[model samples]
Target chain A: MPGTRGRRADARRNATAILDAAVECLSRDPDASVADIAQAAGVGRVTLYGHFASREELLDAVFARAMREADAALDSLDLEGDPRQAMVLLIRSSWRIVDRSRALLVAAERGLPHGRIRELHQRPLHRIERLIERGREQGEFRTDMPVAWLSAAFYGVLHTTADEITAGRLDEADAPGALTGILLAAFTPPGQPVPTAD
Target chain B: MPGTRGRRADARRNATAILDAAVECLSRDPDASVADIAQAAGVGRVTLYGHFASREELLDAVFARAMREADAALDSLDLEGDPRQAMVLLIRSSWRIVDRSRALLVAAERGLPHGRIRELHQRPLHRIERLIERGREQGEFRTDMPVAWLSAAFYGVLHTTADEITAGRLDEADAPGALTGILLAAFTPPGQPVPTAD
Candidate 1:
């Protein structure tokens, strides 16, 4: 029983290591080879293959892991205070998570099923949608646009920031502040004064 | 000499009509045939062929024409007032022109030279860049991000608004307001009060 339990624990550790390494390598270079990933993980290719079965499976695992981490970060934010501030916190965290995940997404998109990828993408939107609904109720965010449209608009801006950054027009260091500045003001209900002018 | 000049004028008018028709037809349907454009222009296929040797040439003409119109509309805006208000005016007009041209852009991207398209695109950005400079100097827009980056971010959001509408996520009527709000809020200098609180 001791030997059997130890083997299971070792298997879990190796699988986690492979996933972490896969994301790191694949994110940097979507075309990264399995051998490169296995080496990055410090595991033999055979051991990596033993767990993944194929690149497709490995991509699925990596996508799931990336989404899980993004969700965990989002979930950890204290969305309890001023909804605008809460949303700023939520989005800043989401930006960081999604920025890292975005590179891996290019790799995952080619190998993973489209439906699964879409479903994972919606979770974060739903999270934003709920916050929008809460903010509208609390009289923080604008209600003139539908909660759905506002959320979609916010999401669109969020992704576009990444595109602009990639195009070398936006500096990475300025992204979070720029994003908060843009979104926080937009979220204010139309005709409502923006909070706390200094 | 009079006869020859009259003939040349007639030919110029025909070319203009054909370009107008091509933009109207292609903007609605990118695959609109040469015959369709000729008919829309109140000219015959023979005249159309005489004017444009091939579809590629026709597309090039159509693209050049669209940029010309977009530029003219952008030029007409009274950008002499408040810098933020001037930008909003500039953007609202640009949005209408670009929204119409966006469809033509798809067809042009294939047949037109990339450099030509790039050159045409920069004209509007130059218009925006001048406005951003005025805004920053006037203490209206933020100075933390570079002028180029601010202009790029505004351009990105402007384009994203068109995308959301096409995707059915944003209503067309609500677009200008939503876009103006997002951009206006974002454009304000950090720590400054937004103009006109309700």
Candidate 2:
């Protein structure tokens, strides 16, 4: 029984490795093949197949894992401080996910049901919306634009930054500050002073 | 011959009216009916069908006409003065097209090949790119990010604003100033004094 449990642990570790590698490979190229992901994970094709039956299965696992991690990561951030500082913290943490997961998102979009994607987006969007609401209430953010629009625009900035990176137009290094600065200015009521990215 | 010329002018006027009304109705709602468009145009339903044989045909024509009008409108703007002022002028003109074409764009994306969409974007994107380049040289825009990134980000802002409007999260009246403030802040060479929206 001990030996059996040890083997189960190994299987779990292998499956996780495969999913992580798939995120890396697929995010770099949506066209990345099963063999490519397997190699990146340092597992043989047989080992990968032992875990996931097919490429769709692997992609689904990768997509779900990425979102779950993003959800948990974003949810865990201490968003209770000064609203602007909270936003800065949120942007810093969020950019890492955007940078790593954009390519994988491209892959998932190819084969997944759009309804599933939208469903997954709800929790994360609401989380950001609540933050904006707090900011708006405290007068730390603009009241002129709808809180949801500011949140939606923040998402837009992330995605646009991702596209700009893929197109070789934006450097990854600049994304966090760029996102923060843009959102801060956009969220500030027109006549109010815009905050600079620290 | 004079009578024939008069008939030709009437036909052209009818076609233009239908196209204009199609833009208005479709932008307000993508599911707008042909009857709705014809009525909005103040033309008979038969006249609308005579100009556009089918809904698909009318949508195609609307998309093309909107792009042409946008291209002409943007090209006619003088972009030679202060870089910030030029960008402000560009955003003002571009928002009109965005405000008009966004919902229609949703319909077109549903039925048209994407290559055509990318093709139409090129000229406008390049024009913005050139303006950003000028801004960078004059220290009016950040050189840290790519000129192309700023251009793409501007487009993202427009689309996001349109979506926000549709979702009832943004007001149309707030968009032009919102677009200008965000871009001016985002594009200003970071660490420099950010310009207030005029």
Candidate 3:
């Protein structure tokens, strides 16, 4: 019984290792082959396929891992408070996670099917939608623009800011605040002063 | 001789056809081969080789053509008037051109070197930079943020809007105005009402 358990534990370790290697390899090259991933993982191709049926499956697992990490990152934020302040916190927190997973995100974007991409994005999109609705209810954000559109803009701006930071065009330290300012200005009613976040 | 002049005209026509084919093929498949482009252009591999020595040369021509088109699109914008209004006009005009060249832009983004990419973007970036600076001098925009940052944000927002529209996530009709509104709000000083373009 003890020997059987030990073998199972080893299998689990191998699966984890292979997944990590696949993520790293695919992030570097979205078209990386199963052989490349196996070599990166220090496992044979047979072992890699034994765990994941195909390359598509491995990509799905990578995307799932990325989604889980991002979900966990976002879940820690208190999205129920002063909606405006909550939004600023969310922007800063989500951006840090995004910056870490930048490569994987880009790879997933290229590798995932369009529907699958939308599916992966649903949770975060819903969270943003609720936050926008909350802000609208509190009159903290403009009511004329659709909440959905504002949410879309929120996601869009985060991505653009991330790209800027990655390209060395915008300082990493400046991104969150810069993003918060842009989002706030866009959401707040025209003629109202946007409260500066220091 | 008359025959030589006719042959020269034929060569010019072939070059134009080849460049257009490269743009079309690369836009569809960033990894498209020289042969694919030649086939699309209705020319043989030998003829393609005669016109461009290498695939890299053809890609450079494609990128150059894209840049030239974008520059012409931007040139038509009066970047001088009331800075805010001029920005609105510029966004609408630029987005139209951007919409047309979306495929080429994405292809160049993946194919060209970073330095080459920056070189291609120089004209538009400078145009935006000057517009932001003018807005600041006119007291139409906030002076706290660097002009360069504002220009970058302007470019970023436009690309985001374009992507959203292309993906069918945001409406095409709403794009230009939504873009103008978000950008103007981001650039304007706090407490000022954003001028509506409609």
- TM-score list, all predictions: 0.65, 0.66, 0.81
Candidate 3 per-residue lDDT, tens place, B1-198, comes to 559889889888999999988988877876789899999999999998998998877888888877788898789766777988888888788778877776666666555553466567778888988887888889987766656666766766666566566567777777776777777788877667644424
lDDT of 2 by residue, A22-109 (tens): 8788867887999999999999999999999999888878877778889998998999978888888887787788787777766765
lDDT string for model 1 (A1-198, tens) is: 559889999999999999989988997887688899999999999999999998888888888877877877777778887887788788788888766666675576445653466456666778889999898899877776656656666666666576556556668887787777667776776556544321
Off by over 4 Å in 1: A1-73, A102-120, A190-198, B1-26, B29-68, B102-120, B195-198
Please give the range of 10 consecutive residues that has the lowest summed lDDT in model 1 chain B: B189-198
lDDT by residue for model 2 over B86-129, one digit each (tens)?
98998888888888767787666554543455456778989999
Candidate 3 lDDT over residue span A1-198, tens digit each: 559889899899999998889888876876788899999999999999999998878888888878887887798777887988898888888778777776666666555653475567778878988888888889887666656666766776676566556567777777777777777788876557755634
Model 2: how far is A5 from its true place, Å? Answer: 20
Off by over 4 Å in 3: A1-12, A22-40, A49-60, A105-119, B1-12, B22-37, B49-60, B103-119, B194-197
| Number of the predicted model whose TM-score against the real structure is largest | 3
Task: Give the share of true interchain contacts found in each model.
Answer: 0.35, 0.44, 0.27
lDDT by candidate, in order shown = 0.74, 0.77, 0.75
C-alpha-based local distance difference test score of model 2: 0.77
**Judged by lDDT relative to the true structure, which candidate is superior, 1 or 2?**
2
For all predictions, the C-alpha RMSD in Å is: 8.2, 7.9, 4.1
> How much is the lDDT of residue B162 in candidate 2?
82
Candidate 1, residue B19: Cα displacement in angstroms equals 7.7
Sorted into a CAPRI-style docking class, model 3 comes out as acceptable
